[model samples]
Target: MNFYKDLEPIRRPIKDVLAEQKLFTNFPDNWHVVVADIVNSTQAVKTGKHDDVNLIAAGSLIAAINAAKPFNTEIAYFFGGDGGTVIVPDEIVNKILSGLNAHKINSLKNFSLELRVGSITIGEIIKAGHELKVAKVEIGKGYNKSVVIGNGLKYAENIIKDNYLQDKESIEHQLLTIDSSELNLEGLECRWDRIKPLTSSLEVVCLLIEAVNFKNQSTVYRDVMIKLDEIYGEADKRHPITMNRLQLLTTFLKFKKEMMVRYSKWKIGHFLKAFFETLIGRLYFKYNWKVNDLKGQEYLEQVIAFSDTLTIDGRINTIVSGTKENRLRLLEYLNQQEQKGLLIFGHFVSTESIMTCYIENRNDKHIHFLDGSNGGYTEAAKELKPKLQML
Candidate 1:
């Protein structure tokens, strides 16, 4: 068996490969899986702390990626609303874990959220009678999104939660002694306001969909994608991160507050610094000044490129903005298929959505994290489980 030096080069439109599931490659046995999420995200979201929850989850990814920069392959990660899943080569598993533990400490100190992170290896997964399949989806000119399939991820999640694997072997959690401030979050920014839909009647849907048979998973997901395109038109028509909708914090108090969240608590000098920076940012936004190649038409394209509006891993997950009528139409179509045992899905609706940005220099290395304002994917999964058992 031969494995490519990298997985990003074989990218295809997600819809194009749904019917050709064989294109996915088995994960290398030398790799390890790292999982992390907020421990009590639902309770936090109920208290209107979902934004913080989302930020912490996105923060964990940044920490892990920055930690894994020495690896031969880029880490493949999936961002759940309140947490995230990651895969990396075994050589850097401990390094990634250290970074995650660092993130966990920061979450506790800053947001008072407990972030649980643990690691498991691919060899154990295959030994336990499961497989991990990976594929890449081309989202933009040079960006390829990583997608994972198979029951291995879900199985790993269970192992982490239950400590099914012992401390020295299967799954292990480490508490690293390091300053959380030292964790790298270079591009993580929460500068934008909550995004409103294209219209008042429009609704935002966060969906997680899976098929009854693993072989049919991609095909069923492809149908959902087709229906969505018909209802919402092109990617630009439905993307929520538009430059026209961007607004920056101008008030001294609000800017100071944002600064505290992004960095540490403010000092007198830091407060004044934030005030001046806020004023400069206001001018930047008002005039739409260029950030190297990131301004004008190129910036809009980058926004769309970085937006996490839609994604496909083993399951089809998306944070989409559309009309109530179209949403109902989609559910009707999916439910009809569900009746035939073709697929199962969980969906949550919201009037608006939120975004977090990660920009590593503002040229092209940037991607946005998106989620429905409250209980988007998490709450929907609550309703989806019972249906899965019945089917």
Candidate 2:
């Protein structure tokens, strides 16, 4: 009369039970999990630097996995020379993908290494692990390259769920479109009129908004205001040939001044304002703070052109000749853009003479940058992805 007697018999063999016990013990239930491995391990070993390569490979894997953990996924097990296993809760699958993508980008940027990620739901692993052996096969397949195994998941799902998901191609396309649209607006405006089209000035305004949003210190705001005033004073000294153009520049400066004053009263304004000031300060130091120099003036022009092509929250790594004159020019260009409303963050590392800059609209999410001799722009960006969501 027992209900158990009416149920169908279990089909899994004894060995399967034992294996499942070994792998699935302590594994969380109702979660989606991913396991990743570095490809070409043997090749890295054959190069006679096996120990170093292994350490790096292991470090990269750990970093990538940890990066994903914040989204509610946990590393269940690590099988060195094989791969790692992750368990993700059903409710947080979208979060897990975002963390994974950010980790992938960071790993690529930091180590110049690529990853192949494979993910499977816990339910599938529990059900199919006994019959189809999907978990074992997929985990084994990911050894040298990155691949994901979940059937129902789509790229769009990842994008919608993860705010930090940065698609380089997509970002580039958007930037181009923003610039084109802005340029078209300029064409419709009277060329003889003094005021420039608003489109060209959006970045500057965005920066002001961001500065107001992220800055936290009153002193920082005060300092930024001083710097802004100095920039305006210099512009006044130049005295453009056309009164309309001069008026336009003055009006823009006045707008920023008012925005800065309002920004200082907000809770986060100090931090954002400070960051902007620091960015401008760094650029100034790189250029020796020579605002009136002609070369400095030209550098500012190039920065504007470059700014038009940048994605909000994008980073750029470039090496320019490191000279007092060159740095001064860079500062001038950056300050001009700042006045125009572009939020720019940049620094120059002396050891490598690398000028790394992160530029974005003020309201756009914050993207981090790493400044140093080696190339780690991707890694910095990857790490920043999660932080960007906090915005």
TM-score, cand. 2? 0.26
lDDT of 1: 0.74
What is the Å distance of residue 142 in model 2 from its true position? 31
Top candidate on TM-score is: 1
Candidates in order have lDDT scores of: 0.74, 0.31
Whole-model alpha-carbon lDDT for candidate 2:
0.31
Instruction: Tell me the tens digit of each residue's lDDT in model 2 across 144-263.
Output: 111122222222123232422345456334333321111110001000112221222111111111122222212223344344335432222211121222111123333232232222
TM-score of each: 0.88, 0.26
RMSD in angstroms, all models?
3.4, 25.3
Badly placed stretches (over 4 Å) of model 1 are: 1-5, 70-73, 164-182, 250-282, 389-391
